[model samples]
Every structure is written in C-alpha cells, then in structure tokens.
Target: MNFYTVLEYIGMFLVFVGALFLFLGALGIFRLPDVYNRLQAGTKATTLGAFGAIIGIGLMRPEWLPKAILIAVFILMTNPISSHALARASYRRGIKLWDRSVVDRYGPYLREKEEKEGKR
Candidate 1:
C-alpha cells in the first residue's frame, strides 16, 4: 500500500522470477546436449537470475543495494567472458560439437587466422 511495502512486493516478485530462471538454468545444464550449449544456458541464466535475486534482496534490505549492484555488475561482466573462455578452450582441445549441430562458425575463423599466420 505504501512505498516500502510496495518495494517489498516488487522485491518478492523479482526474487521469484530470479529463482525460476535459476531452476530453468539447472534444467538446461542437465538436459542440453553439449558443453557449449550447457555453458550458454548456465551463464545467461545465472546472470539474470543472480542479478534479479540480488537486486531484489537489495530492495528489501535497502542498506545492501550498493553492494548488491556491485555484485550484479561483476556477474554481468564475468559470466559471459568466463563461459566464452571455457568454450574456446574446449574447442581448441578438439571437443566435438553435437552431431546435428548445423554450423561451425569458429572453425572457419580459426582456419583463416591460421592461414594468415602461416603465410606470415
């Protein structure tokens, strides 16, 4: 009905949304067919889920908002980078994609780079 109370409700809703994403992310990790797919599912989900839940808690607590925002920023910056690094490493190590995967975008890019370096 009032400002803080309204924030509480919104915070609760955000927390619920965050939790739902976290759950779906887990399911994706479990059900996805490959490392790249799983990494994508996990990273994207955790970023949104964690940011939502953290910001929700910050709203509820008020005092924690700055720290919450900081943590959320860290997650936003790191999650995708880390996931990309992991996927790149896996690719370099010759991890095979799922059999039905239709594209090998990175393969061509890598070959082009290799060809250029060899020519150098």
Candidate 2:
C-alpha cells in the first residue's frame, strides 16, 4: 500500500530470483560436459545473480547503495574477463571442447598467431 513497502517486496523478489540464478549456475557447472561450458554458465549466471542480489540489497537499504553499486560494477567487469581468460588458457593448453560443440572461431586465429610467432 506504500512506496517503501512496494520497494521491499520488489527487493525480496529480486533477491529470490538472484538466488535461483545462483543455484542454476551451480547446477550447470556440475552438469555441463566441459570446462568451457561450465565456465560460461558459471560466469554469466553468477554475474547476473550477484548483480541482482546486490542491487536488491541496495534497494532495501538506501544507505548501502553506493557500496553495492561499486561491488556490482566490479563483478560485471571482472567475471566475463576472467572467464574468457581462463577459457583461452584452457584452449591454448589443449583442452578439448564438448563433443557436441559446433564451431571454433578461435582455432584458426590461434593457429595463425602461433605460426607467425614460430616464424619470428
């Protein structure tokens, strides 16, 4: 019936959704066939989940908004970059993809780079 009450409800909903995403991410990590797929699921889902949870907390506590926003921004920036780096390292170290993977755009590029470096 009031603005603060509405915000509290919304915040609770977001926190719940965020928790769900986190649970799904964990499940995906365990269920996926390969490291790449697991990384993808963990990174993307957890990033959104953390964002949602942090923003919900911020909404529920206005005084904590700035810190929450900072943390959210940090997670947003780092999660994907770290995941990509890990994937690339795994690929470079000869990690195999899942059997059902369709395409590999990085293969040719890495090969070419390796060749160029070898020639140098």
Question: Please, what is the whole-model Cα lDDT of each candidate in the order they appear?
Answer: 0.93, 0.91
What's model 1's lDDT at 27?
92
Give per-candidate clash totals.
Answer: 0, 0
Minimum summed lDDT over a 10-residue window in model 2 is located at 2-11
Clashes of 2: 0
- Indicate the worst ten consecutive residues by lDDT in candidate 1: 102-111
Write the residue-wise lDDT of candidate 2 on 48-77 in tens digits.
999999989988887898999999999999
Cα displacement (angstroms), candidate 2, residue 14, comes to 0.7
Residues 1-120 of candidate 1 have per-residue lDDT tens digits of: 889999999999999999999998999999999998999899999789999999999899898989999998999998889898999999999999999999888888989999999999
TM-scores for candidates 1 onward, in order: 0.91, 0.92
